[model samples]
Target: MQMTKRSLPRATPEQVGIVAKQVIAFLDDVRKHESELHSFMLLRHGQVAAEGWWAPYTPELPHMLFSLSKSFTSTAIGMAVHEGIITLDDTVVSFFPDDLPGDVSEHLAAMQIRHLLMMGTGHDQDTMDALIAAEDGNWVRAFLELPVPHEPGTHFLYNTGATYMLSAILQKVSGRTLIDYLTPRLFEPLCIENPTWDICPRGINTGGFGLNVTTEDIAKFGQLYLQKGLWNGVRIIDEEWVNEATSKQISNGDGGDSDWAQGYGYQFWRCRHEIYRGDGAFGQFCIVMPEQDAVIAITAGTGDMQVILNSVWDHLLPGFLPDPVVTDESSVALSEYLAKLQLEVPQLRSESMLEAQVSGKRYEIEQDQMEQAPFPLKDFCIEFDTDSARLTLKLECEDSIILGREHWLSESTITIEGKDTRIAGSFTWKSEAELVLTLQAIETPFRVTLEVHFIDDAVTIHSRYNVGWDKVNTVHGRAVD
Candidate 1:
């Protein structure tokens, strides 16, 4: 399934019938709304029309896809059906007879692969949390034991566990993991390189979430779907599969102005304007607008995901004309704007006399004393230089990173959530008594900010994320050195 020398063509926005002004407006709207987008790519007529990465987030890094992984999992199932390895009519329990509960209910017995595909697993609530908490670590068994209160394919619930079950079923029938099976079938065919997906304790890919790929990779996948499974005239997947997968298969909400109420497809969400998209938590999106022969891929760390889609509808949608527009200086202006896109870095507002007083001083925090601790480190120390500061964090092990005083210092290293990853950081003195430190995980859509107050012989640090949970967490410590 691997191909050679096949990449999406690049062109000016005018060449692709996209108005550069409107596209620029879209960018403006994003910033105006305070949406922290990491990267974006716009495609039309099978060519890349516009693309940009917010600095600190480069083109080469793989961003966490979160729930966007479900769409790829759905594609694997479609291929399995095409190859005769599995069928939509296949019973869920039939694939894992040994893992079934002691007494399967009628509703559980009737659950089908097609039901899982549509997120209609007959469970009234999301089963993922309970399944992962089963303690025994047998996810398959845990899923089967969960009560199915309704008939399969009747109720509509956004159940992630259904997608995991599909992955489990695919692995059981194919004797390979989701990634292994899709390597030759999807990833290799599309030239998606070295994608990483998290696995559960049982060694199965966590199909409902945990996928990472570059923004371009996501664009290519969306383009493939836009092309009806054809890549460079080669049929990577069946056209029929693409047609069915993106079409509405279940009603998820009341048809209103809200996009979430549109409908639900195989693993895609039916959108307004005759669009279907695969989206993830915190605004990762792969939106396919078939009517306009366009695709948009975006990654972000913003709490208000609706604002992103709203901006698209308000700005970008109007630019898609039936014919390509004439070349103009606006296209050049748009290019220049995209080339310079970058997130703001913290700048020093005042000189901190406290810097010289507390520099190289280690402050040890007692965990039991923290009113609200966002980080788990036991101690922290700061070393200041003319242009940058080095921060040392001591937990089970020691980690350090350098933060530029008024600019982002690249190529920094830190351990976040048990994973050692690259980071870019900046620091600024808010006043004579407080310091603000910012760290951005370059490979993920996450930025952590800490405001530290030095008072007498003690320090209080307040931490918060730009997206997701924004509540500030506070911890206090006494200087130990």
Candidate 2:
């Protein structure tokens, strides 16, 4: 049967066998506790029950998926297997005979495609750094050279390099990059268009990470699996493949009740309550709950991933009812609440005593002080208007001006590292002499805050990041007389 591809149907929470009041309470709990959650979509009975995107992280933008990319890579491999281009029992070195090391160990010789898919390549620790540091930038060759201490399939290691190798193998056999291979087979079938994946230096897609897609796209993927690879009425992928991929294939640890420790499938982590998820760093999640016939997709920038899952279990799980329970007042209130949801912008309303004094004054920092800085800002000046504000920054040899409003304002083009990026910004006066500006890169899971404090003759700039390599740092600057 040919299945029709269309947008997911929308339904009120009560119509989907969930209480509207409890749904609202779940959202409230998320806002109160999980402050880093950027966006989420809740689906039941193949319909969208509720959805929301935090301020600056809109549904139109594609958020970075990080390790969530692995599951997609695994799907591509499954497709290739179904096409007979490869098999799980195929030797890992068979596809890249030319790249194999001269003296392949017995463990390496015994490695199979199934071993990689199940994260049982036998390495004790992650070997991704060695692949990145390869002099020739050939990740496949570098990975094959690394020693596999334990025999393949005997040990379980959370290896991203193993996932990358799967990508390389698919490309070698299918004569297309992983993204290209999946475009027609997976993305097109699901009505997902123009998805992007990060590529390695050698032009292969980084299968272990770097996939970007909208939150709803994540929901669609989970829904596909929930339906056993059936989209609408057609079989996009074999049901057997979906069953095997999500089933527990390897025991990760004695994690007791921890979802991560339960077990691991092919590129998917088995969770408690008969759920499975494709998750990434900082809380990008696509959770499929078979028992509830529901799927929850999330994008966030929080370190506490377990807390997010716990919140779902505590609030959402209990809300699912066996029969629909409709209430007019609760449904209306829940709909209104979701429509008005927005991430609060941290600010203070006190009028600054030095607002007018330092409004347009330029301050210059010592050259030696900024030599090792990430931004290396040389001079900066702030200008404020009744409804808008402008911040002008002088870099090593160029100047950039950022314009924002007192409330969240969207920018279509904000240049960062020479690339145009979508950004939303807002500013407020924390005190008479201190101004705080928050800038969020909407397409990415990152935010940068700049706090500039004005003194008699000098200014202090403190910068912070939501998540990155940089730490909180202060730079001192003097008025550029």
By TM-score, who's the top model here? 1
Best by lDDT: 1
Q: Residue-wise lDDT of candidate 2 within 273-329, one digit each (tens)?
A: 889999999889999999999999999987778888888888889999989886779
- Whole-model alpha-carbon lDDT for candidate 2: 0.85
lDDT of 1 by residue, 309-418 (tens): 99999999999999889978888989999999898997777357788889999998776854344556578899999989999977546888888887888767776657
Residue 59 CA error for candidate 1 (Å)? 0.6
TM-scores, all models, native as reference: 0.96, 0.92
How close to the true structure is residue 108 of candidate 1, measured as C-alpha lDDT?
98
Q: Which residue runs does candidate 2 get wrong by more than 4 Å? A: 1-6, 350-353, 360-379, 394-405, 417-419, 456-458, 468-470, 478-481
lDDT for each of the candidates? 0.88, 0.85
**Clashing residue pair totals per candidate (backbone < 3 A):** 0, 2
lDDT of 1 at 5: 57
Q: In terms of TM-score, how similar is model 2 to the real structure?
A: 0.92
